[model samples]
Target: MPNVKPAMRVIYIPILLLFAAFLVIPLGILFIRSFETSEGFNFSNYIAVLSNQELLTSIGNSIKISSLTAVITTVLAFTLAYAVNCTKIYTPLKMAIKTGILLPMLLPTITYGFAIIYSFGNQGFITKLVGRNLVEIYGFNGLLIGYVIYTLPAAFLLINNSFKYIDKKFIIVSKLMGDGTLRSFKNTIVRPLVGTLGGAFVLSFIISFTDFGIPASVGGTYSVVATQLYQVMLGSIPNFNHGAAIAVVMLIPAVFGVLLLNYLEKRNFHYDKFGETELTPHRGRDVGFGIVSGVVLLAMLSVFAVMFVAPFVSSYPYDMTFTFKHLLDTFQSSDLTAVYKNSLFVALLTAVFGTCIAFSAAVLNVRTAVKGKSSLDTIAMMTNTVPGMVLGLSYLLFFNGSSLKGTFAIIVLYSIVHFFTTPYLMAKNALSKMNPTWETTGELLGDSWLKTVYRVLLPNSRSTVIEMFSYYFINAMVTISGIIFLVTAQTSLVSSKIKELQHFGKFNEIFMLSLLIFVTNLAVKLLCEAFQKKSNKQ
Candidate 1:
């Protein structure tokens, strides 16, 4: 491999060191800890995990629930995506459907679990309206509902993007051959979407499997790997060895997810040519799908509506009157206020620093002649497959008794590494589309690589940078599992506060805090969008 420019090498060293210190070291520590026992280094922890019936049961439950969630979410998401992208629905209706499906991505995952409880629990408002308990808000059923909503946006996004490159001419050709509706659909749509569907299923499965928030809220009497890991790590005894063991076990499915994703990506078919002809919609088919899609969207929206309204009421199912007491009580608490501020501080830092590091890393890997950059890419991508509970516990074990313990800086660092893969991919995608000769152009002008990047590349990728910043900020705000084990009294976050409140059955306050997070994240998102728009116009 050719050597990279001196200036580019300078940029790579710090990022390499950052990942080494924060990501590589902690994970290394975790691997060692998983093998340790009271008798010294051995496989006792693994044996304990395997022999424990409840632990094994949790693993089984997680797989079962995640598999079901993936299938259901994939089917629903594909239908909705197909409707919005392919059908001849009214423009307003299409936009509404898209917005409705994407809305779940904006709020915290914990919110969905609470929303289900408040709307479908025994005393739920919707349940009462139907004069019966429509669905259980605990155990497998509750998790199924919550996970579907939690993972739907991801599946929909991937499946929808696959739709864009598909040529409509294939469908027209199938029709021209006198193929019936089902045959045409199978040939044109399903055939091209096979890889995407597999990718979506794997992605959704990993997300649902590793998620702790939803299970913690509504997984009554049901055991899953995420919640079990939390219990072992943070419960009364606080067993790090067993926790590490559970973390190792939890990683298996995620690894499989990553492998499947890679395989699917390799097999994915790309079409450079798209059809010029528009899709002709059938009246009956369009109207039927339109109504069904509308109902599904409305159902998903109602959960959020319940989340918003439940916080204002004095008491759910008991007090019909709306009051501001929950909001006041939440804000007036000194601890809560500090936690909220700490969240804001951490999110802002993560956004700024994470974006800079991710952008630099993306540039080095994509554009520069940086040798061995693939290692860095591998590490970053691997982080995506690691569960937050696993990563957080690893940090706890790695940094315990160190000076960095209990500091906001550690939380910020963990968050940056935890969410690094997405922004890095975004930046890499944006940069890959630029003219390949930009580096040569800079050389011809006697400009260094760094200078060219500073003046030419960065300015052109402004929208993507803003997007990366927002992604980091919003995710940091809503994430709880990643930072749960690392937070101290001095560095508590709003998401963890919501979890704490949930433990004590403080439903109103939980909803209020969740609403606060939603509003704050929404404000940041809108601000980023406005900035991007202004930059584009300028």
Candidate 2:
């Protein structure tokens, strides 16, 4: 324990209210609805839902596809992380690989499904390039391809961060003790990364399992739990009981995934002294891993190449003429323009409010000895355990008919909660590294706690605050799940608008909007990085 200002505990009230109203109450309402029936409340709804063959098949399909995607994505993410960390590759090529791997995340997930269809579909750009039809972009193959791209960025971040704590000298010691190549590799690299590797797989699996954007665009005849839940709740005929039952069912795996991730994360290895150690040169290792990384990045990013061309062509694969009608037509519509502005409005507010709340929570958790600090930390990260669809459905249920329903405020709040854990963790980690005696020092100098924080802590935390803002802005701009059910006609976002367009076979508008979103998100990331570097220099 350390010296802490008692007045600082006042920060807990707003944070608690935020979670209680948005996270707890909504989930409780969902639980109640799951048991609701025509004859009062009972377990009949769950019975009926579990008994349905199609729903069961969707569950099985989610597991199978999510599992396979986790494996392939983990392998790709690990190889990329390895090449960046362990191998001595050319500087710019490695930088390109790092930047390219995260490009998929810069756009809405729905775009990925569309990209897959246009890239590997009948008249896909890749298809034309290869002069042949590619894999079926309808069922399992389509979902598998989209999911791998969707989850790779996050999985890579987790594994790559884990690499920093590992000391490579252990491999040298093992080699001196007569360890062979295979044995040395396992003992040094694989052993230290077991936890993060497992974490990557689990995170990838949950993300794929709960995603609705991809399945909505490319599901065709194959359905997953998210799509089924969407149909039941907002389809031609709404069934609240069945929808609630399915929502509850979706939480089962998320809960288990959270538990397993916690277990894996506990196996952390620490290094007392980290050195600027250079790896021994092996041209074979460098060339092999570098080529593999480059090839995989190319394959994943090649899916989106059509976005830049498909929207600018005259009926792709039929007419070889360049045109700007797609751009002109999309912008001419007031609705499309308003939707894009709405996305920017929501994203900006989410970043501002989200950064404040997350930073406050982190300041309390790391800088204060407040009672229940541990619980606050847990609550801050709890969003990771709930899937976006479930949270969206819960918000829709809890806030129905209230003033908050169909308002921009609700969307911003939900986005904050949905993407809160990562930013909060980022804040906590950055704050924990600062001087722990700032409060005491300020108090002795006759300064209030808030003043000290504003003058000292906030300035030191500028880079992290910028990062949290960027993360919130980018995610809020592209997210389609947690706020899908909450958006109404007046408060529509670009992502949901793209989904609406898909129903009418508007591929031109879809790719155009996707490009817009990707450019916006990429700009935010680049600006954040540059801002951080400039601040560090100052």
Candidate 3:
């Protein structure tokens, strides 16, 4: 028996209130507003959006670029994942490849556009080195490259985790049975990964289609839906009705991605065991895969290398002399300095409060047998399917005149709800593996349920707790879409400030602020890793 039966009930009240106030109600209002027009609620807003040829073209462009990005990113991710797991490569090179692949995640996606510009634009770093522009770093070409780099890390992670469990011994068996190389490879490898591959495509497509950061920076003359939605909502003539309609349309892919992914997940082949076997090492395979994977990793990392160069130069390409004037300029401006402080403030609070809410919901669902507890899981995770910009607009619609409108509380609240699903699932997974009889055993020892939870449950999952905190902190520091509309003049964040700097053609300042964000997130990530390792050893 749970030591105290009512303890579950006590925890349920606050979780329900928080979700009701933040997630459910705001989205509900946005849904209604999508139908609202000057003549009252109807379908005019949506109909007008669909009727516009420019808007329709932008939607088509989003599908085209996102589809291309998904395909290219998934293929590259597979190559990297295969190299890590299958090929015999230099160990130090493998470590570098893995780490470099995910370096983009440390900074905001909004910075991706600027990085691309400084890397390949006519007067760019690499262009100067090579003495020719490789590709135009704007419009469709830039969007393609930026979106690929942005989504590749996630695709690679999902595929890599799945690859670890695949039985490689089948490859040897297929070869010995006289199966051709293609047929043998298909049977041994791709068959088991069809579900994951499909899932990666959907995930990449959804992420690229819904992103605002990459599109905003590099999408010049290429009018994607994200930019169009921004024009309608925050443009010179703001229209809430139409913007909500576009946001509702943006939600279509997310919903489709979720449903498609769920279906694909069911098709995965679950193995009883992943038995290890010795590989037939081919020198050609090793060299081919090693060079290819190295090049891909280098290409992705090369994009951000300008962050180190652009900020320190007197004026990149023109003045080769090193200078700290750009750094000093940023620090001297009080307004700019406050943006960095605001990001730290929002991220820290979001980590603390978001962890509490997610952990509470997890404990409610996994530990207690409360009826309708699964509903909390559903609500907590629903944010995963909704785009961040859509969430920001929904909060704007619902909380337009409320006291929380211009406050940091609104940003923290949105961050918690936006990022609630993953952390909640992490906590739930961590708790599920603990002894189910822990509470019962504690009761025999005369410990109350709450007391047992604090003493036993909390200490056992401290590593997971640390991991959850780091996830919230890094994402909070880097996320832009959901929090973009919520930040005020007084509450500007470094992520949003990059946009402001972009408008003024201040490339150096943009790189400096990006570096600041990268350093901050890297610090949190390192601390969390060190702490988690210590906890594991203990």
Put down candidate 2 lDDT per residue, 318-348, tens digits, no spaces. 8858999989998998988899999999999
Error of 1 at 66 (Å): 0.5
Q: Write the per-residue lDDT of candidate 1 for residues 370-486, one digit (tens) a residue.
A: 888887688788778888888888899999999999999999999999999999999999998999788888888998778889998999999999999999999999888878899
Clashing pairs in 1: none
Ten-residue segment with the worst summed lDDT in candidate 3?
1-10
Sort the predicted structures by TM-score, highest score first.
Answer: 2, 3, 1
Candidate 2: worst-modelled 10 consecutive residues by lDDT:
1-10
* lDDT, model 1, position 264: 76
Cα error, residue 156 of model 1, in Å, equals: 0.8
Q: Give the TM-score of each candidate.
A: 0.97, 0.98, 0.97
Clashing pairs in 2: none
Q: How many steric overlaps are in each model, in order?
A: 0, 0, 0
Give the Cα error of residue 252 in candidate 2, in Å: 1.0
lDDT of each: 0.87, 0.90, 0.90
Q: How many backbone clashes does candidate 3 have?
A: 0
